[model samples]
Target chain A: MKNALFVLHNSADTRSSEFATLAAIATSIGNAGYSSDLLILDTTGSSSVNVKHGSAFRNVTAVAPDKAVGDGADYLVHIVGKAASAAVSLVVGFGTISNRNWAPQVAASFSAEFVTACELIEVADNALRVTGPVMGAMVQKTLSLGDRNAVVLYSGENLAAPEGTDIVVEVSREPAEQGAVRFVASEALPDSGGIPLRGASKVISGGLGIGSGEKWRLIEEFAAKVNAAVGASRAAVEMGWVPSSRQVGFSGQKVSPDVYVAVGISGAVHHLAGIGGAKKIVAINKDPEASIFKIADVGIVGDYEQIVAAAMRKL
Target chain B: MDIVVLIKKVPDPNLPEQFVSISDAQDEVVLHASSQYSINLYDLNAVEAAIGLKESAGATVTVVTADDASADQYLRRALAMGADNAIRVELDDKSRRDSFKTAQALVSALKQKSIPSLVIAGRQSSDEDAGYVPYLVAHGLGIPALAPIVSIKSASERTINVGKLADASIDEYELTLPAMLLVSNEINKPRTPGLKGVMAAKKATIEVVASEPGGVAGVPSKYSPKKGQRAIEATKFIEGSDEDKAAALLAALDK
Candidate 1:
């Protein structure tokens, strides 16, 4: 029988939705005839192991931070939290096993490593699929991992269960202090205007099609309306229209925001590399043949200035 | 103080897609003869960050890479950009080195030479997009690693103050010497190599060292040509005046 292991932090809130999500995933795996193991990490220094078997999980094991799990599991799932540092440490510690499929948190610092190590299939709002290599490009292909080991990183929110499956597993633990306080600062530093593009959930970027540096204000104006970080293409940066720090491409920052809006930007492979992790892409360009349209969830073939301005107003 | 910067050479990703082709086995990508190759952009920023330290604190910056003879040009470019020295850890096939293997090779090279007070590398390489080498190197050397650093606020003999960008806020860290830092492009703008510096670089000799054996193999390639419908077939092309188009786009965005 196939086995799935889930690693999650013990939350103090008994009604935590994350626990529900875990139960749902466990139930789905059980319904599919796979055994589920839950490895819970307690921040309160408790070494007690609580075994809970319900409609979903077969066993729940509480483990210490230093304890290690045995290999040969068919799947590994890591539930990530808001603290990226904490999430990354867990991934590095337990997500080891080269060439295995792992679906880490979409925006985690180590997400790129997972992408490089695994065969990424499709990225959705609540889940992502990773499987063995595909032979040729096929349309509407559904990936099924018969027996290969797969790793999925999820936050335990917005999960969808299989049909006719009811999850009713309850597990609770104390919430430990959040954030990985690994490094201590000497003193508080002043903030600069450096764009926080790394963690931005929404990004609005522009390209040379905006014409001049002055006209780039449209991007900023639109970004301000949506509270998004501003980004630029290499062409704009090379033209001295924007700082290189704002450049988003293979040569610049790699961003995986939830929503990426590209205005007047013709998508190049370099530019697409930076936005590969973006959940939803919206492109606005005058050229219908612009490469950005190929990957965009929604494409608008029109004047970016007018469309962005109107969209900003509507928002 | 001694600072070491790690850099990599990659196919200029800005090249048109037509200039690049994937192998039939879907295991490799071949660049056309006309395709140009250059330093990874983030690695360039790392070089700049090291140079900035040298300018402010009189640190000696040495740039290193695990590449072939073709990497000498980029090493010279780093020299022209203000690195004090360059070392290329010559490998038979650089593509075979994964993050673990690359870190092992780099650590081996460092053990053979002087250990610097600080090591700097780009957060990740654009080609593989794996931000693992820095942390792996740090772990291998038993040192602290701070990554995705946006800025280095200040530096002293013992510690360096820096800012790390997290999900929503900037976290500050004071790292002791003998640490590793993976910098993002927001750290600083890389200076261009001037003509005089370029001339000097052309004349300078790059030290070459052989990489150690038994490096870990790279992840197996699983890329296949995408065969799905790239664009939505029923995409509605709104045709109207700028105002009408703007209204249409707003509605679409709302949807």
Candidate 2:
């Protein structure tokens, strides 16, 4: 039977939804005629694995249980490479920072084909079918990894994994090759809380059409009422109304929230590309012909201030 | 210490989607007459980072690219932005799309000269956006790599300090010489070239290098648009009093 290995790193930056999404993909691969396993690398040196066993893998394994090997991407690549060399057909990882740092290197080690930002994966007729965005999200290209081992980075979220029997599996390890990189420190930004953007169930974003930095608070308040993450268009970010971290577009974060509310956003192609995976889009723009309305499931044409104020009072 | 920055010239990202069309060969997307080319956005950040390093630590900043001769104008622009020198590795449009092959080509070009102590690149180019080339190039050079960095905390001759914004925190790292850093847009505001800088760049000569041919090539088996129906025909517009419309929106969310 053809086998695939899903790689996960239990790091502070690794999102929980990534675990679930990979599990979902694993389940899908299983149904598509491939056996799947999970390799969780604990870079943070945590004693207990926080990820649940509900992931749809036949067996899950965690590497470097006793100590942290987190500082260098090379070490993670070494451990992942060791596990990946055991006749695995596919190596999958999330599009998180650590994964992005090392996953492609692992692919390069074996001269494997590396696919980034994968939105679709299927196995049929002995060919591995993969789809991902290219050219600044203008086009989606599908490729056949025919008779070649492949490494893939998945960016989608919250796929359902049917119930399955899962068990723990142990793998052999070796000391990481010494590298010159060292971890210095990590400091959390001052609380700007609602929810993190990547996996939030709902997102409320504002753009230049929102007017000024003062009025940007409306988007934040509305998001708080819905317990949603706050996002911004590149225009809003460029205007100094929102932090670059909160910017959503081709150059910023790619979000797949369940419901996305675009307030005063004119729907630039780059901004729309970031939210293409959102299940439903609601646009609020004063301009009746705003491009945002073209892809929105629901739209309200009026002054955003009045509409947001009304929504606030109702809430 | 010498610092090398990798840059790419990409089709204008702000152009409307209607201008984008699948090539006649169906292997890639091509833009129409209105398309213009500019240096990839994040690479500008990379250039700014290299220039910052050059200013602070007294290092020469060299910008390198892997594209055909059309990229020379963009390379001159990088020169205007304070890059001390520029190099172009010749690769056909088809070879440039294969991340592994493109990286191999870069590796060959870099090996032609004295390898720089540091290399900086954009997190991803605006076009293709595969984001694998830098890491692959790092792998080929057998060096450590860090990416999507938000800021540089400190720099010295032997090592440099950098930070990347995580979900909520900024993760910092210190790396010794012979490392790669992929910059994010938050790193620094790129400076506009002055008239003198532009004049100098116009007269500057760019070095052209030949790429060695041997690495795995990655071409998509098929290429197409992700969505067929971009514009929803029957978008439900909530119409009523402001409060009533708000109520309708809330109800829609409940679905």
Candidate 3:
């Protein structure tokens, strides 16, 4: 059985939800056919209190006992507070500066044993799946391997199987697959709370040639008009016009919104990965060639900015 | 002191006309590297930061990339921009892999040289967006780690003062010698390599290799959106005068 090392921002007593999320995530890992070990760091005061074995954290694969350096499994994860923590040699930083992602903490604590690897899959700008048949992709994905512990991404609404999968389907933002995944097993946590999406909507959606950040004002105007929220294509966000929070793509937010509108947005599969299953999709790109038009029951092929203005006028 | 800065070659996260099926079909990738925004932004900045540090502290800077032959071009730019050397960790594997093992291989390489006092890296790479390497190296090396450092003040041979751009406030810390820092856009402004540097970067030598055994991370699944069905009715843009337009917009959205 593979092991997951979870790192936490504070001890369980402090960040209860984080612990809960870890348990739930651990449960998901178990469901996916993997085991987990948790690590929690309590920087409540100057004195660093490290809990180890089963005493401080029950079932933790390997918790840091008195600022112990590295001794963990294959996967290290940091949870709660974007700060990076290490129980093992593996290091990871996620979630918000305050509410970190659940997996990195575990990965960090188990850094030593777990050899982490990274892969780039083929997916649309808005979605995170590599192109290929689902079955073949599933087989390829399953057949393919990474170092002992690795973080992988895919698009669609499935985790490939009912059990025995050691991957996670995180619906949050995915930045460059570079040094952004921070880890620190030795000392002070990798204080990394560069949350490009906090306080913003849980999921944002945008579309089409949001070519320039200034032009994004048009999309933002529409988003403001609807108050529904904003998400963008790999196109607009790349143009550097919109906030990464508002980006929607295979590499961005996977949103399940109360309301979603595909304004001036094309429904590319990559883009679809980020906005698939929106309650309501309203496409308004000018290009009838825009794929979003196909997915949009409410397709409008005209100048998006003008149409948005018109729509705004009507609203 | 020698500083090793690691960068990644990733696809631009932004593709204008993208489709999920695009990733599904190999023949369908819309764009290539240098086209992706974040990879260039972060990678370039990493190179520039290395140069800046070398200039400020009288250190030699080397850049390493776990990328392909094509990225040799990107790394060469680093050398042109004043990086002493560029090492490319080329892998034969084309199948999707994870970041952990790649970093492991990189750490091994860095160890051959003097262990860097401070390793600088981008906060995250654009292609994978997994965001977890610099921390792993720091952990593996058993050193202190600082990320998102926006400001820095070298205090002495033993300690360095830095500022962390926290969510709400500025968090300051005095880092002791030999620490690893994961930089975000928050750090010092990263400069662009000049045409001269870019031309020079093209000729640098990089190393590539066969990746070791990485296991199946798992087949990722798609997410199901919970949004309701959109109206099948014809979409009519609410319109009127400027005031009417604003009113209509507000009325339609009811925000």
Candidate 4:
């Protein structure tokens, strides 16, 4: 049977882990007729492994280096190198910062084929099919890997965490090579005060039409009224009305909120890509022809300030 | 010292959805006549970072890309924006689309001269969005790759400090010389060329290199949307006065 290895690198300080998505991916691999296993790279050097394992993975293992390996590319490469084996037919990872820094290097280590932004993977009659949206999520591209080893990177916002057994085999190893990069420190995102955007139950976003940085407070006011996280279109971010962390678009944070509200947003394809996972979208725009209305469950064409003002009063 | 920045020309991401569609027979994206092409926005940030580094470290900046002759205009734009030199690796459309082949071709071209002191590219091109080429090149040349950095905090001949954006924090790192760095948009605001720079770019000569036969790693056997993917249908606009619209929107949330 073909074997697939799903790997997640965890840090104690990190709030949201891609464990759920990795588990979900492993299930997809299993459905495609491949035996899947889970490997967690614990940067915290914790001896205990706490992951809700599902039937998707046949085995789960947690690895930590004996020495403090700073979150650098060299150490990540070293860790993945230690865990990856020749017998694994597929190596899977999430497209996060730490993984992106080293996953390709591991692919190079084994001379395996590498693909990124992988949205779906399935096998039919021995052909490995991998599909992902490219061109700002405007089009989808599918690739077939025929009996060749592959390393694939997937975005995790689309899938839920797997549920089942709780078992992990913990192991430790030594870093044999000296590192080339040194970790200095991590600082909080500037001016990113308020509810976090990702995983928010509700989101309210503003765009260039918000007028200016001062008026951006309206978005916050409305969001507070509805208890929604504040989000911004790329134009708003570029205009410096909000921090990049608050931006929602192809290059910004991807949010999968239960409800996403767009006020004064023109609905660029890139902005729409970030909110694709939202369960319900409500668009408030002055222009009736705004693209946001197309995908929105409910759209109101008028001055956003008036509508938001009315909604705030009612709330 | 030499700093190399990789750039790509892609269909303008701002193009309306009506202008873009999938051609099933061709197994690729097709842009209508009204669509436009520009430098991948993220790569523009990379170019800006490279120029800033060149100005600070007194290094020569070289912009490199693997594409056909049509990409020359974008290369000229880079030079106008402040790159010292530009090189284009002549690869066909098929080869250019394949990340492995593109990396191989770039590796071949980069080797013709001495290895650069630093290699930089956008985290990913807006088109392919693979983000695999730079890392592949780094691996091929046996250098470490660090990416999505927001700022180059400090720099010296042998080492450099960079700031990377994490979930809600900024992670800083010091990388040794001869590393690969993929820049994010937060790095710097890209500059527009003035008349002087534009005229100079028009007069500047671009170095063109023929692509070497880089063996294929693995090509996709098929390219298409998922079989059962659903297209998002247009929704009906909620009708009524401002007060009624607000009520309807809030009511819809209740359901």
Candidate 5:
């Protein structure tokens, strides 16, 4: 029988989407005839007896963090928690296996520690493969682990379970630890009137082709109308047309939105790298040969000023 | 204060078309003759951060890498960009390094010398895109680490205040000395090597250290395209006037 171990984060809110998704994934693996084992990494050092009984999975088992290492399994799926510190600890815990033959998959927020663990595991064991910072939708569509010995998939925050999947697992606790670095206090900076771009479902970005800082209103108008976050390319940021916080590129935020709209963006490889996880990319550039069009699902070779305005009017 | 920055040499990812698939499994990519290799983009930012610190706070910046002699070229570039010294951790052909192994090698090398008060590295290497070495190094050294940092707000003799960008918000941290910071590209603009700096780099000596064998080497790569993967082709092009194309794009966005 196939054995799959689901390593979930012991979240504070049992009804959180993160927990529900993990439960669904565990249930799906069990239904697939794989003898699934659930190991919830408790960062808060909470008791697991209550958690195991309260979980939706039948015969749920809580594996201690220390003992969780080197648990022989055909598959290891890490459901990333919100706390980067907890995720890092869990990743380091499981990553201690020098040469374990287990396909590990992680779904997380693409934290530095988690990504490093995935890289280290892949480098340490050829048999183990890691895929993700995978989105929840992708996980739902491709949940089958099949016969892989070791797979690592990283699911991000706020994931929903697949259709018809029941999410009935809840555990009460505080949020996991942030990391080794201590947080001093939250400083409120001057408002830039920009939304967080990392996890936004839809993003409307402008590039260097937009020309001037004043011209960014075109992007702002488009974003406002579409109810999407505003993003800028590295060039645009460099040119001072937008804040560096709003830049979406390798040097900036890595985003994987459902719909990424690029206006006058030439689609530099650096820009494309940040958007690799984007589901559907729409490019609007006058240059047909622009690299952005190569990856764009739909291409529109035109002037952004006219096209975007026209598109705004239609919307 | 003494600072050490971790850097890497990676094939210019911008030239993806020039990447040759060597294995039938399509697991490996070799650079074409025309393709050039450069310092990992984020590492360059780390180097810039270190140099900026060195200039502002009076510190010596030493750059380290766990790569072969061929990396000297990039190391020289670091020197030109303002690093005081460079070290190359030599490895045997069979000795492959995952992030842990790489960190182990760097740690071993660092142990042979005076441990720096501050360690800096890119958030992640562009090629591996793992972003693990900094944390692993910090963990191995039993030091504190902060990552995805936007800027070093203030630096004193024993403490440094910095900004960290989370998914939705920016958080601040005041880390003591002897900490590791993995910087993002937003930290600072990396300066290009000027003529004088380039000339100075040519004369700079790169210190070489050999890494012990069996330092956690097994996985061949962090990323491998599944078999039968091809370049994406744009399925539809809204061909018409601006109004028609805009309308089509809007329609597609709705779908």
Candidate 6:
């Protein structure tokens, strides 16, 4: 049976390694007949997880991770841990773009850390709930691998220390992953700038002022016409169109794409940190005078839907 | 209830200045300031939380460190903030990277004092960022532990509420008493020792027993921000009423 090792990275914000996430993933893999083991790499090796809840943390032993060369487990699912590169076992987050750029680089990291779970539980098929775009993509990728597949479940922001050709999940699937497919990226992908912003052209973006979640489609539609990637302002994200990882500016990704389109995005100083380097900016807003116009190379003064429609026609 | 606040001093990893000369010469980064952020913040929060509990329900606060005479100012500061007393456990600074040795020393010292009802500390000292000591301390004490706790409340004398972060959500668990906790920014804003408390602390003479120095040093490479002209402006926002004005402003911003 293939085995999986889950590592919990220590975060100042988290209480215990979200054992529930581990337990759920463990159950899924176990039902598939692969044994899984959980490893809690206490970055702060001193803290405890209250493993049994209000109980002692005697559960953790000095069981060092198996050496990389000897790692025979099929998949290693690292939830939380910090490693600098894809060569390292999976940390809970994504590594640099260089790692995610290739599936094999990320897959190898997980292969290095796979360990079978000692106390495995049977999980119902219902537990394989797909989360953000990356997670959905990862789950789909792993399922496609069938039995004996090693997998790593990480957040969009966390760096990945993959083990091997193990399945890696991300909301925004890269066009290069030979086997993976994008199921919900056009939707969930924008929640995060799953792909690099600097490499993008004809960029599509939104802001908090977009109002409701339903309004997010406006930016998406504009993007669809221009064949552009979607981007968002902090204000738009605060409204919940996207996740924190997708936020652009000082708080989010730093991108320098060509032909940046800001739809209903008021130019907030905080949003400029990442977008400051964009080559060309186009602003569209119903308000004849939104802050986004200040940075626009081309400003359209009218209803965004009308301008966007007119632009799409030209494309 | 007896509460112990575990604090540590290590090389400030963020400050690039100290790392430069040390890296080239000694090949290791050294601890600079004694009143480091992690330890100080954790220590004060632990002390304050303990004091609040004591005043509210009567828990005793004890501040201990694996530091030496050099930590006088910081220890004094902790005391001034109303830590009942302080203890110093020394260690030989050999690898300086092996804080486990320093933790061993402190744990040994604490075992002699009483198994505290609550143990709290910063997630990790800023210098080492090797957030291991608290867990080891908990392991040594043979009790449940929680790290990176943001909010805390006494569920009972032997139980406390801990707010911890998880990948998807925050986990709020009621921890059994006499457990260890790693304090984070979420736990509570640490209180600064006020001027009045400083005066009173001056009158306090802490007993210092010799052991060894904390044995955790590191190689901190200096980080000089690639030097450039620094701008003093805060944040800028685009504001306009008409499309022309807004467009003009946007053009200016792109520049």
Best by DockQ: 2
- On a 0 to 1 DockQ scale, where is model 4? 0.55
Off by over 4 Å in 6: A1-315, B10-22, B30-43, B92-96, B212-255
Question: Which one wins by lDDT: 1 or 3?
Answer: 1
Task: Please provide, for model 4 over B15-83, each residue's C-alpha lDDT reduced to its tens digit, 9 standing for 90 to 100.
Answer: 876787767684667789878988888888998999998888888999998998888998999899999
Model 1 stretches astray by more than 4 angstroms: A1-159, A162-217, A223-261, A269-282, A294-302, A310-315, B94-97, B227-231
Q: By lDDT, is 4 or 6 better? A: 4
DockQ for the candidates, in order: 0.23, 0.59, 0.14, 0.55, 0.38, 0.01
Taking the tens digit of each residue's C-alpha lDDT, what string does model 4 give over A1-315?
788888876665433446666777777666666888887777776676676653458877777665544444456677667667888878898655566667888887677777666767776665577776677666767777767778888753566666666555565655536567767777777544657675677888999889988889888877776777899998897677776668786656677778888989988777887787788788889998887888887778888778777877888
Q: Taking the tens digit of each residue's C-alpha lDDT, what string does model 3 give over A1-315? A: 444445554432233333443444445544333445554443343344333222222243222323221211111222222323232222222233322122332344344222112112322322222221121111122212223343322223312222222222112221211122222322222211222222232223555455555666666565554544556676665455543434564445455453455665656555665555455555555576776665554445555566566666565
User: Model 3 chain B, poorest ten-residue lDDT window?
Assistant: B221-230
Candidate number achieving the greatest TM-score relative to the actual structure: 2
- Residue by residue across B140-207, what tens digits does model 2's lDDT show? 88887887688899888889898866656667878898999998887888999999999999999999
lDDT of each: 0.60, 0.79, 0.47, 0.77, 0.61, 0.46
* Candidate 6 lDDT tens digits, A1-315: 444444443323233224444544444544544444444333232324333221111122212222220110111112121222333222222211111112222233332211111111233352221222111011011111322222233322111222222221122111221111111111123323233343454567777556678877766765664556677775665455654334465434545666676777776544543565567676667676676666666666555554544444544
Instruction: Considering only chain B, report the TM-score of each candidate against the true chain B.
Output: 0.92, 0.91, 0.76, 0.88, 0.87, 0.74
Q: Which ten residues in a row have the lowest lDDT in candidate 4 chain A?
A: A65-74
Docking class of 2: medium
lDDT of 6: 0.46
Each candidate structure's count of clashing pairs: 2, 0, 115, 1, 22, 65
lDDT of 2 by residue, A57-96 (tens): 7767776633334433546677778778758878998666
From the highest DockQ down, the ranking of the candidates is: 2, 4, 5, 1, 3, 6
lDDT, candidate 6, at B101: 59
Worst 10 residues of 3 chain A by lDDT: A131-140
Candidate 2 Cα lDDT to native: 0.79
What ranges in model 4 sit over 4 Å off? A9-21, A31-33, A43-47, A64-75, A156-164, A168-178, A220-227, A237-254, A309-315, B21-24, B225-255
- Compose the digit string of candidate 5's lDDT tens values, residues A1-315: 444445543433233444454555544444445444455545344564344322445434443342222121111222222222222222222221210111111322222223322211221121222443211101111111223333343432233454443333333343323333456644542223545574578899999889898888888877877778899887787576665667785445656678899888998655765676678888988888897888888888888899888887787
**Candidates by lDDT, descending order:** 2, 4, 5, 1, 3, 6
Which segments of candidate 5 are over 4 A away from where they belong? Answer: A1-21, A28-129, A132-180, A187-201, A211-214, A231-259, A266-281, A291-297, A310-315, B24-27, B93-97, B219-236, B251-255
